[model samples]
Target: MFLKRIVYFSRKTLHLYLQSSTMSTFTSRINMVTGNNEWIFVDDDDFDYNQELARSAFADMLHDHERNIQYEQAIIKTIQTLSKSTKKIHVLDIGTGTGLLSMMAARAFNQTINSSCSLRITACEVFQPMAKIAKKCIEKNALSHCIRVIDKRSTELDLENDLQGDRINIIVAEVFDTELIGEGALRTFSEACKHLTIDNENLRIIPARATIYVQLVQSSFLQEFHTLKNLSETNQKIKIPDGCRHLAGNTIFDLNANEIKNYIRPLSKPIPVFDFDFKSLNDKTNFTKEKILENIQCDYDGQIDAFVMWWNLDMDEQGEIQLGTIPSWCYDDKEKEENVQWREHWIHAIYYPQQPKIVKAKDQVSLYCFHDEYSLYFDVGISPFPPKSFTPTFLSRSAVAGFNNDNRRNKYIQALEKSFSNTSINRCLYIGDGLLLPLLILEMYPNIELIILQSSNIHLAHTLEEILTNSSKQLNYRIIPSLDKENIDFQTIDMILSEPFFTKSILPWDNLHFYYLIQQYHHSNIKLFPSKARIRCIALEFDNLYKIRSPVNQCCQFDLTPFDEQILQASLNVDATIEPQSLFEYSSKKPTLSSIIDLIEIDLDKISQKNKIETINLDIPFNVDGICNGIAFWIDYQLEDNIWLTTGIENENDSWVNYSKQGVHLLLKPIEIKTGMKLSINAAFDFQQGQFSFNIIS
Candidate 1:
């Protein structure tokens, strides 16, 4: 006998449960925006035990040809070098995602002619699903005879059982993140050297060494994310509490250096901070926390706001084969910089100093760099010994940064000022998580009574109280957790305002919560700050970003098309219709393949009294000859007939809003289109369900 049960986790997640006397399985549906997980029980017959393979980001990593080529070359170099001294070479590929590196080792051995030395390659993948995929991938390429795939972590491999007592002389692994040590590379190497590998002169690691580099930059733009700023050039200032001042700026943000080149002004030349020798990690001291202080000369006269960090990997022993994550500006060769392989798996990172420092040209400032086994951080000048722990700040650093955007704030301020000047708005209601809009209104219009409706996020409510306590302005405002007619009179409310940034809204369009609010609390006399919103979209031709969604037919002469099929089937079953991405981070020569078109125009005032489905169909034509890989869309708030703000590309220059993620609907099959080629798009919006659907016919 079997029983079926359904459980509700949150508004964002739904879970269904199925149970039998003999067996039970759990499945989860996650709400991307809220990041809530719902678990469900599924029948054994319906569930695929191997579905975990679909979750791996191997396609993106495997598609990185530069990384693949470098690893292969390094493996070949190590194998050839070891062959000269030793009769046999044993290689271990740690965290082997697709067995690509192990297969490369095998191919290198096969290429060696008349060689008495034989090759034995063992690859370990902790993820069972990926390990299965790696086995199949190796078998498909007919390299299964030479390479053995183990479904266990490197630490779990036993010398006698796993390797048959073979001493691993050559180790090839790519266990790294944006931060050189963030991925537990130190511990992995320490364990492998201690237990799995032979520590000898002939032993070689693919990436023999890594050097971390840091550059100081003075940018008010980057500082905005770390600290709060004055509200709209007004006397009322938003202040951070003394307790929260020591809070470390949020997690390190990884970005493409090319995308942020315009925003940052370099204060110092790139300085080599730390070096990690992977081949010589036998010492226990290498696993301990270490701090180094280097005096960096400030090149320009400016305030040092943040530091940008990147690393270079010496892929081979001689350091001839190299791979780095340095920005284009660091490259001396123009061609090399222009053709720099864009990799999603690895990129540059930015770290914020706890406090900004003022420096002049030729000023010598002590740059303190610290790293543990799995993380890295930076400090400037004399700092506390052992460093202060990151204080808990309820506010998201990214959100604070978005709130400080000058352009976005200016737009909102202008719209608000214009609306206040023209219309006599008295009782105003602000609905959203952010306090910037409501606070601006209070500062500008002190006489108007303002009520803030924050449905959730107690932290935001507390932050607002702290700001109000610190603020000198005597403002007429009230913060309400939820809307209640008994406590407040909605009938008298003249204006409703929101940045439309709701706590639960993940996608840009999810802010349609604004529309829903206006509908429920309908008053014919009420005015909206954003009178309407236009959903605009443009077809894009991504150079390499498309590979993330596309099928990998072959990676280094290995047929892994089956992996693509499995991922596609899994994605179809669970993936969201639209994926949000910071398009600015993705690099391309010519991104736009079509002229911007409006899919739907939503009038806030004219929202249907009754909940119903609203949809639109349009024929979109290509303006350029390119492959249409995906369509990028964003919301443009019509603050007024003339005053508008867009959450998409800023202008014709192709710069996007750095703070907001635009929605991308990647096409399952990319279409090669020419000028004037038209694609029919049927877009639907379900108001009742609060969902969106877009179907494109090429």
Candidate 2:
């Protein structure tokens, strides 16, 4: 009999493995092996470090300052709204993570209510561990008397048994996901209103209503993250059969409001799709699941490649206090100033329609939005007719335009052209993910014998072959899906072109997939396009980017010191964290060579599969007055002798080129730096684990 093992890697630590009976002395060991540096064997019952880490991450929610501020203010406003009634204020905090809102409600009640009465808050959390943590947090804040922590879900609360048969006056919940309702918000709210709250018309709910909004956009950048749209010129021109609709993939990501203008071009004004009222939906049957926004006029003449969606939360009934997740471009001059608050908890979602609608300015269209119990979907059409059914076909189309790319394809073509103009190649081998490179080589070197190392995606390969057939060109090429030294005749292949992409890659350095493909044959005298690669880093001063990962010891005038302490203890035990960040969207204090440090350089011709861990420690000197938030890192690929492609820091004066992924490692807390300061930095990378760690040594 054979036993199976499951392996997991922390972002900045050793690889961990789990197997049901190690068959080694005793049940298991905890990071017990020495000098292997590759694997860490541990038992599932011994530590459960992953579960602890998840609990610690709950404190991270407090770092969303905008969310905290809005909730605090809404709690205060709700207390005021219920103050008119002679009945004692009853507030229920649903899914309370850190008891932050319950504490705020208690404090607001303490301030708003007179000496005759007191405020009571019932805090409910489904997760038992989180409930315990919240209880500790409430006790630490001295709000234990006014707030009660329940360790069960809101639906489990018994009216006659748990609440002393008291009817609640106000209900507060932050139980929303990226797709507004992904966390069963509809069901939870419906249950609360029907059973938990009072029957009075004056009953109040924090975040009284939420309105969904949508705007048509033209963005290939957004589309690339979901699916590779077949982008051949002939494919772009190919018309779909009449009445044929292809549903593109649904995309959800935390889009930065400030940097959206640089990547996406808007084609239509933002239109309000629908609004969901928590107070109005007392019965589950009364809930709405579909809505249609008809006759929306297009303001621009272009291909509607995708739809940008976001929502606004009306925290109070009067609408005096509201929180919105609109991109910076949509905000007026007043809202762009320092008065407005930004949030990471809620960001815009980009949706690709069933088919990208190509239209002229002033063209009118209707959009139908459908929602299941947990998620939302949308479809678009030129006619004002409503969709026959809520469910749309899932179609991944290959129709993409050049302008939609922001001209990245043009840059790659130029680099390829420059490389080909100098070398005379009779036989070429293509090793990359996309078909663009192969198609370009075929068009440029008409007589060259080309062999493409095709991607594992058979559909994509078939699409590429179809594209070639559609062009009506006679090209000499063979698509080889798999490669090894035994099958390939290396003696005849002279040059290799690669886009350096892999489906399994998650970080910038994962492009080493390109190196691994050709390393075995490097000594055979075959040249590679990117002959060299360098990894670079620079210290950065983020305006507010570090808050997402920063320790939230205090928020909105409340002391969450206990939660912060738990996170600190967890950090002291682990060395794993390589967080993904959009560093290009941030501004570097300086672009000088002194500010930038080249961490490691790899010779594409010499790298091997058995590479060892590399470490670097240096005392870097600061030359400017700024706050050190994190270190931004990117990769530079040397395509030819002088020409290169980089995802590193690009000059603001120059146009943007590389769209490759970059990374940022934020410090535990931001530090103020001045000129003449010596900053000690140490970093290590373990290729086996595909993890990197950065430490700021005093």
Candidate 3:
């Protein structure tokens, strides 16, 4: 019997992997062979690598592969929120597989009263084969008059061309992966917000918004599930870092996605959730330099290995895994996917835990433990009194003592030189989204290319499209976008500009969206028509496509564009802070300043959830070795250290919540500056604490 074989191609030659045991030796040349070869042997045909690459296309794999079911929920949900005016709305669909949702939107528009204007849906897909199939699907659905599929990558969707007409009122896409940035989302959403939006008019993304959440949990199904073999070697002790769980659980961001029978093990920890709306495109474009949220407290613990954030989006009311359609793309070939569920190729940050410990939960009773590739860690018990401090032994790759082997400045210079020599493009500067850090780097890289980016703006699409359509086009070379992130790109690009989040957004300025649309272009290989005009940047979005709640009022209805700061202030006044925690250290054992909880003698893969963790607490005036990357840690600091807010005389009437953090001593230094202020300050030496005291200025 002929065994089932799956075939696909990258830049290399074709690979044929058998799904079952009833297979034979793999051969590719096509020559008439005699019968009865141990395995099935057909004609031998030798094909060149270039020819093989030409033959490779993801169309068939994306369209006809019975692995995924098609869903139209995103379109339906989008239509539900639209009024007669929103009819014939311009819709951009990114990663349009089979054009199912796009077709639905077109059909709905044809039936809407506000259909006087042409209803358009721009669909983008990279794989030539898949894009062709999507067109055919659109035709079959009788949506050729409205739905247009452009088989291009998101970054390639230039705002100058594709976005030149009337701005799109909505965007729909299925660009989310485990970690939002992993699936090339950074470049996709960023461009869309910059160049594809409606001028002054409001646009929507199906599913309205997306919420990202992270939590710590325990799992033990790993060992038995993996089908262990080399018992002795596998059981040997391994070193893991503090605050790291051996088993990083696998789950889908799609709310409706299923959980397979087998689950990966993980340690339980408090979960952090961040939410964003598409209409609010500022956060995704924010850069690292000027928009820095110092000690933003991704985690509360002192020791932090990394901040791994995942994203889940609601495409439509049906919660379509792909832009509000029926769940399809998220699924795997059940018959063949017994070993894995879903995964994309990408890398994120790794901020490991600090040595020793800072603050541990004062109420916990048991110890928690886990391990990373480098060291073992544990959570010790809380203490009511002061403890002796010591130097720390860091086993993790954190910002610890000697964290950097070489000077970062020198490395930056070298990289700048290399990029200039390679690209033959000099006077280059690197810019990324941040509050204040990137600007500093600009001064350092001034001799080369100059780059400046916003920490809260998603305006790279226009600039990117200019480069793509002008320079050799490649989606990988564009600025990345996000809903909650400041900025995140897939493949590294050139200089960055101001972020869209904190900076004034494009929506406030009308008529610019259409100008951007006019500047779009398609990739060279595939000559997809309407798709080239498709705003892959804006067309493939899911947030802010539905009910738009102002960022100020997380739960309130927010339709007015350019959300008012006063509303934000009002939201802050009512938004209560949850359980607070400052820098924390979680180890299976006790945490002391300069102490290390080494999980050296532990079997990482064999680690079970039942293994209890240790915890230690701190009350007053103390220091610890370890740190936590938890939200509680940040909120606590926000409230206690006076680091989260500040006030000036001009802003005395403005009792605003400063989203900024301050120094440790300022926590309780409540200055009672009266109407008129005077100064009579003096500086004196305090030899004991090796510091000077703060004199009052009245």
Candidate 4:
């Protein structure tokens, strides 16, 4: 049977090879395996047209019924009010991905009573592929006659050719990001208002204005992400270099709505920071540089670590039709909050202060908010605006993220302390792309010699060196750029250590590179910090995350299945079955549908003798009656004999570690199961390829 199966696989592979070689298109793309941009030949038909769609948050935005309904209502209101005065309405839809807004305007025009009144919609999409899809979508909805899809940016649109000399009166756009102006909304709107649209009272924008709100907060949880803390409990301390100390951290986008309560403690009530009138923006509008000082009184006595920001859009001129990105906790109406459509396209943003400040209750502090044409940033406590020419020091965002994970850091420290107590380590070889573990080991065990095999990330290596050099205690360590076995004396090496961080690791189990290294240098004397690893999973009934992968059969009364079919085919052609996602950032209720089930376990000590492929089959029973839409998977490392560290859920509540993202296998077709229903799951790990495959049998 095994021989027959192998024969079948070989024949299938040969057939595919021949089929692919028949015709191919040469293209340059980043090679994941080689970590370089290289030209490669692929089958012409195999090109993934859904690459952008697969990575986009469009599904989430489409699933947002509130946004869709509000946009349609706003469009209908604008068209109805303007038709009374004008015989024709020329509408401009900017960044019209999938052309939903333009269609909405077309539908609104169709409902008008004036027989002579005509609607001309010009939708400009910067991405040519999406513009093509938008044209198809509009044609599919039978609105091609009214809506003209231009495959160009609004800035590049020629008025005579694109609009045919028609003056645009209604401008509808949804180009905002987590940071309201992060996507260059100011520039887009300014240029459109000046060159494309008519400057009159009848002219209107879908989202008339947007108001940004911010609240100061002191969060030790968030502080760890921006600032480094002492790794060891000993007298030795890790000091930040003078250069990095005063550097302003990058604004963190897509802060999970769930994390607002889990990580932040508000120091002040939500204060309105800035307001941008989209309708009023023109080329003459000074959006280049602006600084505003708002006096805000502290509600609590605490250190201001970061500020949480969100925005509310006035969909119409009256501000009655409103859409906000405010957290659920701050909502005054409980019912509205309960029914609020959670959207990932635009979420909360967290901005770290260049320097943390301490303030007492009732003490007034001036919040300095600043912005350029493209980005918004904030400062606090009466500090002078940073010089226009000043550039902030660069800190690796990934490095800060990895170090900020207190849960992961504590586990590593505990495992190291426990391992050091039982084992005698004279010399150690650390193989990973992290600095914390190596630095901690050197600091805790000053007498031992540590060698780091830093395959990449020279910045981390330099920072590690600077930190070590500046320390009071003399530490013995050497960083080797590559794994040159000739330079290392393996006979004297007592242990191998790693945080299991690799730049190439997209999934959790990719860290198995460390295990592969152990197998390569199989030494019985060397003790491994993570002696074993297990790949585990749990079925999930996602609230909205499933939509990101699911087929969009219909959206806003339009059949979007043609677009969905293309996306589905593209995903099948190029995308992985399982993708990495920060689960905590996902807005869901009781996502966990089943208890954690171990899919496969690897004993590091025995990995050297293992086969090329390992398979496991299990029956996963549902704990709740709901739709099982996804499978969340993660890795658990047995650091010591009894000490275990999980990259999955931190608790029974299903909240994950803030920094690490987990693997989510989205089911193409969601299945409804009652409590106690079981699903047969077949999981296989290909050691040779370092990849995993899972199959669910209903």
Candidate 5:
């Protein structure tokens, strides 16, 4: 009974869980404007749903030809090796997202033998939503007859009941997290070896093994993403307090490793940390319960600020098929020049120690990694030092890091410095969410009483209060979520500052939370920092960007015609969500066509309760010779009379601090255009809908 109960989990399901669990936490209320008939209820759940719907993970996996090619080769190899047996082929797929692996197995089985032999698959998914979707995906590809999705987690499957008393011999799972052993790969394999598979010694795993590698580095640029403004810098040397270096945190995000070389200077060569064999991990249940420690001697002496990590996989038994996520620079010059496969699904990891350690070239230290089946954490101790117990914790440090490095923050600081320089405007009022502007205004104008309008994000409100109270030099300020307009004297307020950012804002224009506050004092003479702003757009030829949205008709040697039909039908009901991306970070090889165009220019200092256009249309003519995949948009703010903050700035000569900033709207399908073509864009900014729509008049 125990032999029939175990299963495998795919990398796709792990990606799904990450998306659902990492959504931003936001507070909401029904905000009904004077002119708009629709009441806006900005909630986190709805925002998260929209965000997930907008992600093209399925399409991205489909377009990843290298990943598919490896999986196909591995599946075919496993099938061919196992086909010598007269016994039926029994397989298990864990975290079966979109049923891609199951479909691959079904295709492999058909190619290996005739229909007389039995080939059965038990695709298990703990996420019911994905299970239903995977069923449709498998059926659409005409593999439903051989593959059956069991809407249950692998741990929950009963050998006798769920598996129908059959033991699985072929386990194809891609449950690896960025940390490799993350996502319970070890625990899942251990359980499978104990209960799911037959007594056969040659049970096959898709990824035969994975090895994690790490390198130490001294990176001031990477440190900014972890520490806030308290760590000031002088002449490229940061003054990070001793207390700030004690907590090593992991930065888990998609990083173009090759580009990271510009910011980080390596202190040591890549060193292998540990390796996990998925085929025989039954006795390794302790990996998920406690810390796994490794001691390594320092090869170079430097300020060890971080340990950069990456992993590579042996996809089959023969090791002929392989996939690696090491940044391009890690390879020699020859491989760097080659067009290596760069994937967004997997990237490098950074382990920032609890305390940055200084060591000599011959010093030794213990690097400890801990996990609890779902996620990973890391810590380090000096050589001969006792290993400390490590427990997993999650915080919104990433959010803080983002605010610290945001290009908008630099613009805000500049605006505040320019505004308060020898000016008579004394009293200042700050409205809207976010930390950058208020922190700057207080520090620069120490004497002026700055009144800040806070929101329901208690963590942010408390953090701000604590930061202000602990400052060596305090400023005159009042913080509250709302003001009693009836008791306030709007006439005395001389300056109004707003980042135009709100936690509840899911769309770019939703920052109008600032505009809503401006409406209260329209009759007053208060000066607005950003007197005007506009939503701008430009046509672009995003080389492979659109493929993430629409299914590629031909992938490898397989045709996704039926899958494309499913995606097209679903697109009718599921409107694409606009996600913020670092447009500049994409490969330089991709091309952009046409000039930037302003869609709607709004006067921030003025508000009208009488007239508003429900829809606005513009005929944009273009003469570009490129594959027009989509339009990229961003907000351009007039920070001051001559000062500007444009999120869409792409000028190489521009002296502004550059960061990733842009929102994209991919077309339903790519359109080909020559030099003589014109594009008519019809757009509507609907305040009632609390969203905007753009369509090309073909």
Candidate 6:
């Protein structure tokens, strides 16, 4: 009989289960906030929810294109960019969510091979439900032979000494949200690199860099997450975050709802600020970038939403895994997307020229930014406020914003017409947002080569249908979804084309954490909780991956006309995915469900024991939003997680161990192991002064 299950679990769940499965703890009063009005907004320990309502609401989000599918595209793009070595290549997919990355790598390899070369893809995800779903998809696509999904985390990639041996050619994960600090990107990526990146053997990280642009805006809708709202004792409010530290050099602000709405202060001119590279990054390392302008300016004041960026990993000669190359999206591991949850159009933090940048002024100020890893500053002659312009300095919508001058697009065409005149680039591929822009370039420049990256049609096609049909046509260029159900655009887009979306999982540090939490929260809301005698499956066209009987609710309400046409029709026939492993195979294997859960339970027990004895001093200068400056981390002790996760930074260094002036802390509570408890932690570092992790004997 099929049983109902959840995608993710909470610390409390893990804690309770680890303590004793027989205990079966359940909260009497569940207060889950539905939206801004229902923002319990803090630890779940205090909030409760109606099981049915929570389940129903969550199921809706699972299929929501605006929310969940965006992430699907992220994994898709990350996977599409990965390489499958000519020889047998070993892969490690962290947070394998539906095994998208694993499948992409496997598919790429299998496609490139003539049947002799084989590749293996192993994935680690702590969420059992997500693992199961991934396993299902992997098996459905017949990838189970090469890709194995483990319900564990990257930190736990080291198993009972069995799953270890050869280093992986790729370690792909899409854990980062907006804020770099939230997604445990630092910890997971570092751990994976150390474990997988042996001496000189190369490995490719999907996103080589995550760049964040900091801009000033005027919006009060996002004050809650941004932490810019007024704190009141009666409202259970807290101090606002560093969002208001505007010209004070606090570039990135992890805002909340109220902060988003209350932010009316405007520095109109778009400036190029803050560039963080994920590659070659260290806990305490420093770097700079050169002349980047992802941030933009609008005609009117608006909330700083996001500065969209994409990955561009350079491959070695043989195309085996190689590091050191930089992807386009670079952030200082700062900033996030969820900080503004209400609006769906798009959010951005623009950086315009002008020192004492004006709130309102009309003048043409030539802002030349020398943004680099070593140093960053701009040459702004005139420009009071960041400035008010209808057109932006950068366009992150998609491939329209090419990585280099060669990307065939209208901007490049304009540049070409002005600079190269008749000369144009040869052989070009555009990845990430902005398909129409390239088409415009095609119309204008005619001679340059063009390639478009469409991460996922199942994700955008639905919305794209609505978007394309409703939005006014500015030009002849139109990115219409194809008639096929699975593919997006089959015939290459010279003036127009779209590739199935699939790329890197890693992101800018701020976005890494922020969006990670948002995804978890959103996923929790959208997870397909299986019901008894029933199975839940992604309604992939042609062949639905549904089970006959299950207990969980299976439903999603989102317009998919765009996705269906754009993606499905793009392909004449939808190819089946990997096969699904039996529930028995998943739960009964040697290091099977019980075995893995048991290991996690043991660790959870240790954490519970430690938690009971001693609690972290949240009063100390840190929180999920981030830690206040002037804080130092002390390595009091480490956990036995077989990773750097064991190491926790203390506010001060003990006499024995040396502490970094600025270090990161794995901000998650000890793993909680309740069977159905699911929660997402917004862990952050205290920077100069903060502490994470705790241990004590009661």
- State the lDDT of candidate 3 residue by residue for 459-538, as single tens digits: 33332233234322122222333322244321232332211112211111111121121122112221111110100000
Residue 87 alpha-carbon offset, candidate 6, angstroms = 1.5
Poorly placed runs, candidate 1 (over 4 Å) = 1-51, 237-248, 282-286, 385-398, 485-487, 517-519, 588-591, 606-610, 650-654
lDDT of prediction 3: 0.31
- Write down the TM-score of every candidate: 0.90, 0.81, 0.35, 0.90, 0.81, 0.34
Ranking by lDDT: 1, 4, 2, 5, 6, 3
Stretches of model 5 off by over 4 angstroms after superposition: 1-57, 110-118, 125-145, 231-251, 259-261, 282-303, 356-366, 382-410, 421-423, 485-489, 588-591, 609-611, 614-616, 619-624, 650-661, 687-690
RMSD to the true structure for each prediction, in A, is 4.8, 6.4, 30.9, 6.0, 7.5, 29.0
| Model 6 C-alpha lDDT per residue in residues 281-312, reported as the tens digit of each score | 56443232244343234445333332211112
> On a 0 to 1 TM-score scale, where does candidate 4 land against the true structure?
0.90
Residue 20 displacement in candidate 4 (angstroms) = 9.3
Preferred candidate (lDDT higher): 2 or 6: 2
**Model 5 whole-model lDDT (C-alpha atoms):** 0.64
Instruction: Choose 2 or 6, whichever is better by TM-score.
Output: 2
lDDT-best of 1 and 6: 1
Candidate 4: lDDT of 620?
93
448-473: candidate 4 lDDT, tens digit per residue: 99998876667667667778888887
Q: Clash number for model 4?
A: 0
Residue 354's lDDT in candidate 2: 54
